[model samples]
Target: MDELFQQADRLSSSHIRDRIVEQLYKQSNQLIKAGVTFSKAQHNERTEKLDAIFTSPIFGFPIMLVMLGTVFYLTIAGANIPSSMLADFFGWVEGYLTVSFNNIGAPDWLHGVLVLGLYRGTSWVISVMLPPMAIFFPVFALLENYGYLPRVAFNMDRLFKTVGAHGKQSLTMAMGFGCNAAAVMSSRIIESPRERMLAILTNNFVPCNGRWGTLIILSSLFMASGFTGGMKSIVTTSVIVGIVIVGIMTTFLVSWLLSKTALKGVPTHYTLELPPYRKPKFFDTVVRSSLNKSLSVLYRAIKVAAPAGILTWVLANIQIGDTSILLYIVNFLDPLGQLIGLDGYILMAFLIGLPANEIVLPILLMGYLSTGSLMDVDGIEDLKQIFLDHGWTWITALNMMLFSLLHYPCGTTLINIYKETKSMKWTFWSFMIPTAIAFLVTFAVAQAALLFGWG
Candidate 1:
């Protein structure tokens, strides 16, 4: 024991420490074979398994993708009904608010801002955000409970190694599903400063729930056009899955770029241990992952989204120089927006939606509806009509999906990057890098469409 301690002290490197631990663990196992206690032997065996899987390159990455896809699928499919119900309830409330305000002779501006602008926006937030999160978080918690998440880290260890990041980034990326800010904070698990910064910088590429909502909505409405009946769901699901794949590819690309440039370093190894799959505690999984995580996210969305709704309503309703502030801003951005295969309103929505990516779709709907004053449309088909009014061709939808796939991190993610790196420079880069990629991709696509006479 003294020699093992001395060996550990003499070797300051992680590699040396790992080797010493390995040898000590092996000797402990041998002692157990010589009639040591069951508990002690089991403990040593567990440590060895942990060391081998975490440090091993094989069987790490495939597991990571599978876990990620499963979490996303659960969130995507589960959120559907709750979102619809929430929207219906909120729309019902909106009708009552209108009647009540009109009955009391409330000022038009105040009614518009509070009820139309503020309340409607909040409704969108609750309806859209609540259900999926309620579904996603608990399922996520279940995964965490069964200790599947650690195995993900174990499986992803090699990819992290090649990219000069800690294998534990798998866990942080998982956290990003809940919220990018939380994921960024989780980067503290990485001991290497450069790798930590790299993880922080590139973390935004993983779409949070807010971004996921936008992707899902866009895919379902626009990209699912080729299919009918039951096939539509499958096609839409495929599109959503494809968007996720793009996000992941983008993450790896950005991470690779960062490692070769500012945050360059050789990747460090990790010792991840896959815990035996435990039968998930059913109710606890629901309470912790599904209910708690969903509600927490919904609570945050309502807080941020309510104010944005009010602001958007105000901008839409207030007339300035024969156009509302919303129109004025959208008009100004139109040409640039058009170049990227989106309208000015879409561009403006993305700008305002910086605070929370989840709000981007709601904001875009607000903008589009404001143009036509279509304040009453509720169904997805109604949304399809609204897009048709705005000249949303299949090409337009494709570009929008592409833009959503590649856009900058939300306001929460930006703050997360700043917090994790503690550097405004890195945060700025994190924002700019993705935005640049989005613009370039969209621009190129639009140009190609025009050149081929597809527009």
Candidate 2:
């Protein structure tokens, strides 16, 4: 029909696009007419052959739990010695620098900011961040390489759709493993405007690799005190994994709530194509997934962290009324932080961590070391002592982890949300809703803990 052709022409300029849609429609109709069915054994055989335990509800979540545990187990087990080594190495360097600065008659402020602030910041970054990232990313890549990741998506797809989001959001959330900004950008695959916006707003619930590093470290330090040997690793890893899973669950919960209220809609249907498993190329996976992802993200973090480090250093050294600027800021933030089971330093870390979640720990270290010129951390144990000295408790640490998992997208992700939505209102809400939810959830957690003996 001329009219039909005209309408089709208006809808699709490219022949291939129209043809593919037409073909898929035709095939779907044919299957429907045929009353598509397969034997129980046949279905079982298909699922079994695919080795989809990673997607089975009974086994999938447990697999995820184990995988996450293994990654953190490796990170905690691997990072302890290197973290101590780096700390001792850097402390010696700091002493050398301080002496050299005195000999050269360097200005007090100059020595303070450079040797105390910048050097300490960089040292904290290397000692705290390096080992975990080095171990986690490669293991994650191996899972990804083996086609297990898609199974994760498949397992979680139904949950995502129940929230009126694209099922593919599971895949995008998986992308958040490497970076939240990348995950937000990957939302373009969602064709619906409302669903896409939901994806952008909630993507932060999946901890980016940087935040994952922080959670792993903090959980190992704070939550593993009662256990020892392999059990310690298992417990620490389980806690971190539990936190990650909670984050993901929060994403779905928030998405569902938003869809029912502010962003309501039926989810669009899509068939996720599962590629066959292949032997992952070892050298290529290492180069592309592990080294490249880690280094690129680390480089971006250092740029932002360096300036914040300098600022915090200055705040620490400059005293007003016997209290430094850092203390003043922390005092100001403490009341609000109290409601959320965090303190000023924790809040400040999140604020300064705007540039990259990767830098939050580094920033916290910088803040702590502000009064001293010593840089570097001895180990998770030493880091725990520092946090404990500053009034950290199990509730505080748990809520901090929760807040990190639920809070606003990092600066990079906000920029990506803007690019994806091309609307400032959507971008603003994408930041707003998650922040509100993070506060509420954290507040509830804190209150509940205090109400019980748990706090």
Candidate 3:
């Protein structure tokens, strides 16, 4: 092998590897013809036609988008009932916790911190994070098992290569929709260090499961108005799909910019095998995905939620003159937030919800309620009323969705980026790059809305 490699290096001008492969194929054919008695070739016509459709440049992207949108629609529709059920269960548990604390003669502050703060925070995390993960991951894993995921990467390879990134980045971006932290960790599949870094920096542009939960809620609340039944569902799903498409476009644009500037490099060639389509092992895929991806994400989120819950509780309760510190911070942030088409409470929610994106909606509702406890609202109508009371318009909701899609990665994702890169500089860029894009995009939209008198 060493001698062959040396000879190939010496004949580099002739592209020796191609010559070697050609010669090897020629010899193998000769040997087969001489030794074999008979041979028959078999082909699957269905797979061939499917591949032609899936890999065609004109239709490939649209097909991929449709498939992705279908998956998201199913996950969103499927997770709702379970999410509400879990919330009710947790809420019941909270009632028991409060009574138990009272019976034990726990101090008011301790009870407030333990029950309203830590316990409620963990409950919200579980209720919001689990259902989506459970639904989304297994569906995604089915795609992987069915061998469609690589075709997705194949379809996207040209675009990523044009942006001077590894084609495998497409797979990582897909993983990001399940969880950005998991996606960041999955960047290892890319072989080149520079391209891998590009993948890491750009992964956050794909909204993760946590952000999806918030986006779905806002979409249902704002976009479903004036439409009935099926039309309503269609509009909501389309709006969410539109936001996801924007995130994907942003990923490509930023990847191009970084390739041309900061992470300058030419695209490296790579081979991608289009695996044979096979029957997916449904039970095994679901069990493995739930244990490996869903549960792991839930665990990481719970760890951060507990401490963040306590801190948010403190901020909401600690008095500053007549108002709590939380109110003071919101007031301070309101001006900039408004400039970006979001209010102080929304901005504060994003900041406080940094620990876990699953908690942002809960925290925002808590802020609106002016209660120290994070509580669930009655339904979509009630939530819409609360937003209307706070002067939330279509512009506000749209920009909020945009910002959520483009903003900084959650705490777990940031930590994973740091771990993967082992450099504070890249991790910092990973944070600032998306955040800068988010601010600029929202600011422009807000300005445009104001100019059109849509604000």
Candidate 4:
């Protein structure tokens, strides 16, 4: 068996499988020409031309960048009015709910838990999550259904291979932009154990929907102080795309580091079948994406966040030695947080936000208010004001975005990681790798800003 395997290896060449595949297709074509009478598809030529441009060495990456930036820009801009409207609608409903609770003589804690905790959290998740996701998923789906995603993987395959990972990891990372848990599950596409693990561990570096919302707000701050009108959205999108690039770079770095250290192995090759690009039915694509990806994700987020809101409320209201349980946790973490250019509230938010990233900003706002109420701002203007009141500067905003980008997987994602790997040890490393990197990156930037007096 060993000698036979060695002989096969000696006879084989690089990309031998690809060559065999081509030869088989060529022979099949010959047999078809002799025995079959079917018209050749004209789209094959068209597809070849399209791939030539989309997969070209010169135009491929820039085109991909432009397409990606457009999707995100549309998502950011289109979501604004709808998100605001949803917030307003929810607030109106909350007012009526509050009146009903008061009329029913409900206890304050009961109202807080039911109305403020469960209902508010669920509504907030839907409002904030649904808008951007509604815009992003369908747009992304159009690209996918039209068969552009494979070209993305093709273009990125070499770079990932250079980092000792699979080319298909690019697709998983793209999935991460939607949800890291989904991305972690998507890593199953890469058959190599080492490469799949690399993909899973680094998936969090790609900001998920919740983190994207955080980035959008932070990126807007950069533009809010400067650019206006179209320039503002353009600049904001540019910053976000830049952050996305940063995340990709971090993915490569971590993948390479892990490949060299913990999971050292040779890279494996896999055949990628690029399907013919079909003009997708726009409305159908939108409907399917909305129902499958957007609504489902929103459902999961709300499920996780409602309980988180209850926990936050309980911690905020319950006091020990004149400090709320929430406050004590915040105070304990403040020094460490400050070392990373964040405050206690922001750090504690991330800890509690382990359950769902959707609740992080809300929890932070809750921590900021001494009234022990879960915070919900009316608009970005109000939210920005709250951050400013809390002494957040550009460094703070920058670090907050960075920390959010690099933090550990959300609770659902961590659970998915364990389930997928069925190994608690891998799950533990998946959590640790990102957390350590988040701290290191944020702490270094904070220290450097102080060193240069950026404040």
Q: Against the true structure, whose TM-score is highest? A: 4
TM-score for each of the candidates: 0.86, 0.85, 0.89, 0.91
Q: What are the candidates' C-alpha RMSDs?
A: 5.2, 7.4, 5.3, 4.1
Weakest ten-residue segment in model 3 by summed lDDT: 36-45
Better of 1 and 4 by lDDT: 4
Across 293-412, the per-residue lDDT of candidate 2 in tens digits comes to 778777777777677778888878889989998888888999999988998888988987887887787777667765634454555567788888888888888888888888888888
User: lDDT of each model, Cα atoms only?
Assistant: 0.76, 0.79, 0.85, 0.87
Sort all candidates by lDDT, best to worst: 4, 3, 2, 1
- Candidate 3 wrong stretches, greater than 4 Å: 1-46
Clashes of each: 6, 0, 0, 0
lDDT of 1: 0.76
Winner of 3 and 4 under lDDT:
4
Q: Per-residue error at 31 for model 4, in Å?
A: 11
Off by over 4 Å in 1: 1-70, 228-230, 371-374, 452-455
- Show where candidate 4 strays beyond 4 Å: 1-41, 374-376
Q: List the pairs of residues colliding in candidate 1.
A: 54-272, 60-155, 137-289, 138-289, 138-290, 210-358
lDDT of 3 by residue, 215-299 (tens): 8878887877878666666777888888988988898898899899988988776778788788899999999998998998888
2 or 4, which is superior by TM-score?
4
